[model samples]
Target chain A: MANVRLSSIKKSFGKTDVLHGISLDVASGEFISLLGASGCGKTTLLRIVAGLESVTAGGVEIEGVDVTRLPPEKRDIAMMFQSYALLPHLSVSENVRFPLRMRGIGSREEQAEKVAAALETVQLDHLADRRPRQLSGGQQQRVALARAIVSRPKVLLLDEPLSNLDARLREDMQVELIEIHQRLGLTTIFVTHDQEEALSLSDRIVLLNGGKIEQEGTPAEIYSQPETGFASNFIGSANLLPAEIIDGETGPVAKFSDGQTLQLALEVSARGPVTIALRQEDLSLDANGDGPKAKVRTRVFLGARNRYVLGLAGEPLRALTANDVEFSAGQSVGLSIDPQRIRVLPR
Target chain B: MNDRTESLLLALPGLLLLVLAFFMPIGQMLILSVSGPDGVTLSHFVRFLSDPFYLGILWRTVRLSLVITIICAAIGFPLAYIMARVGPKLRLWLVVMVILPLMTSVVVRTFGWMVLLSRSGMIPEMLRDMGLVGRSFALMQTEAAIVIGMVQVLLPFMTLSILGVITRIDGRLEEAARTMGCSFLQSFRTVVLPLALPGIVAGSLLCFTLSASSFVTPNLLGGTRIQVLAASIYKSVTQTPDWPFAAAQAVILFAGILLVLVPYIKMTGPKDG
Candidate 1:
């Protein structure tokens, strides 16, 4: 296991820049996630670290060695593509042993042993002799993971490897990934666009937007305290409302453009124009309460929870409620949220 | 009518044409092969097989065809892989270049080879100037000339067949191989080659059969000294005026192709397992 440090990496295609100048330092054996929406260059950044793509400028150092100009084969890294990219001609055992065979990691007997251990780790030992084409999607994904870990490279790069599986399989693989990381302690860099996957997997989440770092922190730190409206909206998908904060006789109160006033947390000392972001699950909906009155525009049934879209103070708001709390469309309801849960951002 | 019957009815004319045009000639040749001057006999078959001269010609034909097939495969595989990996526009250009020789008539192409391989040809002259070969050297009227001409004529069939298969191979497999620690060429050899075996086998079969049966290029480039089965069969009928002997040779050629093909088809045949 080793640390990966990327300093001022930038990539561009012709006149269009995909990644702006960016820098990041991942400590030894840390699981760092580069999370963003599509076209945010998170995959590009991961590919650069894997040596699959060249940096337009700046350096990539793996285990304190400058490997910026090295080819993927020369770099001590293994990447798992989202497509699985298993060799169709080889059996599952051979696929898992490929990195060992290519890198000349061990003798034939040792390679076979490693392959067996890797397959057992992924719970695919029985299907060792079967070709990749014979395996199902989830089985193929496990084989890919086995192949990536067989070499025990300095760094493990996964490019949205779980995106192809179904939701249940994704969850299972996520837990498996965590266990594997714990057992092997390989410095892993996972690139994904799913915020929830990033939140659940990474020791540190580096949120990216428009090819630049928007925020970087632990999942709880980033989620609980988003610094910008974009970060707030992207992370929790919170509803942003333009507002003005002023010092009141008490602590501070935020006034929306529609004239609804809500108390702010004492920690928020900023007064003047600002934006308030309220998470959907943080809002509590009641039919007979004295909180901010809002009209329910739509309700989405989400198994155990129902998400209600409401129009509050002339702006749209979303709140998650228990499935038992039934509210018809166009019905006016009161919405309440803890002042601590509200995130206020400067305009 | 039902769809199956209707489709068969629509295909009747082509099937009838094939039976009349293809099967009828083969049937006639089979009849003539068994016929003799006095009565039906196996004298022609026994005579051809027993003679060292005729046996040498048969041996030469088989040897040359094998060499041509191997050469075509050697060059066609990497060429097809390049075509499959390149951008679409370049791929179109590559396809045109591969099949360009097939567009020209065989007689013209053979003459072009004759010019290039002759004693005074550009190739021999350049080699002599470079002191690589003696001044009396010539590539024409030799087995080397025949193999070269046949490979050039049949390379397109070999390459395009493989290209069609290689393009359908998912590119992600190579990328995955790289991450698995394979270099670019290693991935091509290990991953792309095995996946493209069906195409290679198919192309080899076609190249072998076509080179075995070919006449014009081999006749012109190889001259009268080096004779293949097709040229020998042609001489028996046209030059020697021996129709029965010619028919016997033709039957042998037909049987030889089928003899080589049955095992090949079995190797690639659909698996009931």
Candidate 2:
């Protein structure tokens, strides 16, 4: 496994810049995720690391060696594409053996042995001779994984590899991905738009917004201490409400526009106007409570919980309450939350 | 009265047209190939096969056609791949460029080649100026001239046929190959070439057949000194007024092409192989 570094990387397509001078460092054997919405340059960054794309201005170093000018074949890396670009002409075994063959990794027998072992790792040993077209989607994904890992490249790049699968299959593949990473400890850079997938899969999530790094931290740290409005909203579906921070008798409290106030946790050192980020799941709804009274605008019936859209001071805020505690549309309810759960970001 | 009969009845016009327009000429050729001054005989076929001059012409025709088809394919594959991958505007321009030669008359195109390839033409002049050849060197009235003219005319057919298939191929396959550690050229060979084989085979069939049967370019460029099988057949029918011998030679050419084409068609069957 190897660490990958990108310093001041910039990419432009005919006057419009996609990646605007972004820099990142991936630690060795660490699962780092570049998480962003579509068209945010996460996939482009992954492609640049794989050498599939040229860097407009920057250096790409892998394992402490500068490889900005090297072609993909010369780089000691493997990338699993979103489409699972298995060679349709080659059988599964041959597809797995391609990198080994191209890199001249081992003897014929040795390559075959590695191919067999890699296939076994993906639990696809029985499909050795079958063509990729003959396999199912999940099986093809496994074959692609097998092909990527067969050579044991220093860095593994995955570009939304699980985004194509169905929900259940995606979950299964996620588990498989975690298991494989744990077993091999490959320095993997996964590019995905799904926040939950990034949070669940990566050791560190680098949140990208408009070709720039918005935040970078562990999942819990990012979820709990999102520094910007974008990060808070994108990461944990935090409801943002403009509010002013005022010093109370004990500590600072965030006062919403409607005169209702939520006491801030001791750690938030903000005095001026700020945006209060309260997660949908973190806020509790009760008909009888001493808190901000909001009218239930809508109630969506989820399997295990009811999501109630509340109108708070003329702004819409959503909350997830347990299914047992039912709330009807247009009903007045008090929205309460643990002050520690509130994330205060400077406006 | 029933669905089967109704379907057959609906197909009757097409079947009759095939019989009348296609099979009738072939049947007459088959009969005429054996007919003699007195009665039906094998004299015409036997005579053509026995003559060294005729055999040489036949061999030259097949060899030149093979060379032309190979050259067309060698250039067409990459050209078609590029045309397939490029943007729509660029691809349209490339397609038009490839087919422009075909839009002109074959005789006109051949004369253009004659102007470029003659001793005093630009090609030979450049060669002489570059010290690549002697002052007496010429490219006209030769098999090479025939092959060149034929390849130039047939290249569009080969390229278009392959382009139709290559464009339909999943482009992601090539990207996949690249991520699998394949160089661009390696990806072309391992991914694009195999997927485009059906089109290649089809284009080859068209190139070979059209090159084999065409007489205008070869007749104009190769002149009387060099005669291909089609030119020879024209000589038999028009110059000598030997209808039976021409029919026999035509039958031989047709049968030889079919002999190669039948197995090729079988190879291009619906099975994956």
Candidate 3:
């Protein structure tokens, strides 16, 4: 295992700049996730580290050696593609043995032994001789994972490898990925657009926006304390409301456009126009409660809970409440949230 | 009518064409091969098989066809791969270039090769000037001349068949191979060549069959001195006016082609289906 460090990497395709400049350092055995929306250049960053893409400027150092000029084959790294690009012509056992064969890791018999052990790791030992086409998507994904880790490369790169699985399969694979990381202790860089996947899998989540790092922190720290409006909005998909922060007798108060006011935490020092990010689950709805009032526009039944879309000062705000709480359209409902849960950012 | 009957009715014209335009001529040839002036006899077959000269012609035809097919595949595979990977506009232009010779008449194409392969032609003159050959070196009217002309004539068939298959191969497979520690060339060999085998086999079959039966290009480039089987058969029909002997040779050629094709079809056919 080795640490990977990317310093001031810039990439451009033709005249359009996709990655402005990105610098990140991942510790050995750390699982770092590059999470962003489509077109955010997270995959580009990962590819640069994998040596699949050349950097326009800057250097990539792995294990303190500058490998920016090296091709992917020369670098001691293995990557798993999102498509689970198993060679169709090779059987499952051969697919898992590809890296070992290419890297010239061991003798033929030793490679066979390792292949069997890797297949056993993925619970695919019974289907070793079957071609990739004969396996299902999840099985193919396991084979890809086995192929990636079989060689015990210094760094493992995964490009949204779990996005192709269904919900249940994705969850099971997520748990398995965590276990594999813990067992192998390989320095892994996973690229994904799913915030939940990044949250659950990575030791540090680097949220990117518009080809720049928007925020970087542990999942819990980034989730509870998103610093910017975009970070707050992107991480938890928090609803943003335009308001003015005013110093009140007790603490800071946020006044919306329609003259409704909500109390903020005492530690908030922001003044003037600001956007308060309220998470969906943090907001509470009550029919006979003393709090800021809003008119309910619609309520969607989500089986375990109901998500109420409410109109607050001509803006739509959504809140998740218990399914037992019933409210009709056009009904005026009280919206309350913990003062400390609101994230205040400059508008 | 029901679906099966309707489909059969729709296919009746094609089926009739196959029976009349294809099987009728083959049936006539088969009958003629066994017929003689006095009675049905195996004498012509026995005579052709026993003659060392005729046997040499048969062996030369098979040998030249195999060489041509192998050469076409060796060149066509990489050319098809390049065409598949290039941009569409460039690929279209390349496809046109590869197919241009096929659009011309075989006679015209053979004449073009004759101009280049003859003693006074551009190729031999260049070779002589470069001191690569002796003054007596000549390419025309030789097996090399036949192989070269046949390859140019049949390269399009080989290239296009492989291109059709290579274009469908997922490029990501190569990228995955690269990340799995394979160099680009290694990946092309291990992943691409195996995947493209069906196309190569198909193209080889086509090249072999076409070159084996082709008369004009081989007869022209090879001259009368270096006669292939098809030219011999043509001589028996046109020069000697021996219809039964020609029919017998044609049947042998047809049978030889099927001998090479049946096992090939069995090997690759079921996998695709």
Predicted model with the maximum DockQ: 3
List model 1 lDDT by residue over B1-273, tens digit each: 899999999999999999999999999999899899888988889889999999898889889999999999999999999999999999999999989998999999999989999999998999999999987788999999999899999999999989989999999788777777789999888889999988999999999999999999889999999999999999999998889889998888889999999988998887432
Q: Name the best candidate (by lDDT).
A: 3
Write model 3 residue lDDT over A65-177, tens digit each, in one string.
Answer: 99999988989999999999899888899999999999899999999999999888889999999989988999999999999999998899999999999999999999999
User: In angstroms, how far off is B56's CA in candidate 2?
Assistant: 1.0
lDDT of candidate 2 at residue A340, scale 0 to 100 = 89
What TM-score did chain B of candidate 2 earn?
0.95
Which of the two, 1 or 3, has more TM-score? 3
For model 2, what is the alpha-carbon lDDT of residue A35? Answer: 93
Ten-residue region with minimum lDDT total, candidate 2 chain B:
B172-181
Runs of candidate 3 with Cα error greater than 4 angstroms are: none
Question: In order, what is each prediction's RMSD in angstroms?
Answer: 2.0, 2.1, 1.5
Per-residue C-alpha lDDT of model 2 across residues A178-243, encoded as one tens digit per residue = 999999999999999999999899999999999999999999989889999999999978899999
Which wins on DockQ, candidate 2 or candidate 3? 3
- Alpha-carbon lDDT of model 3: 0.93
State every prediction's TM-score relative to the real structure: 0.95, 0.95, 0.97
lDDT of 1 by residue, A1-347 (tens): 34888899999988889999889999888999999999999999998998888999999999899999988888889999999888877889988988999999999999999999999999999999998888899999999999999999899999999999999999999999999999999999999989999999999999999999999999999989999998999998999998899876668988877777888888888889989999998999989976778999999999999999999888999899999899999999987889999998889
**Residue ranges of candidate 1 with Cα displaced over 4 Å:** A248-250, B271-273
Q: Which residue pairs of candidate 1 clash?
A: none
Q: Residue A116 error for model 3, in Å?
A: 2.0
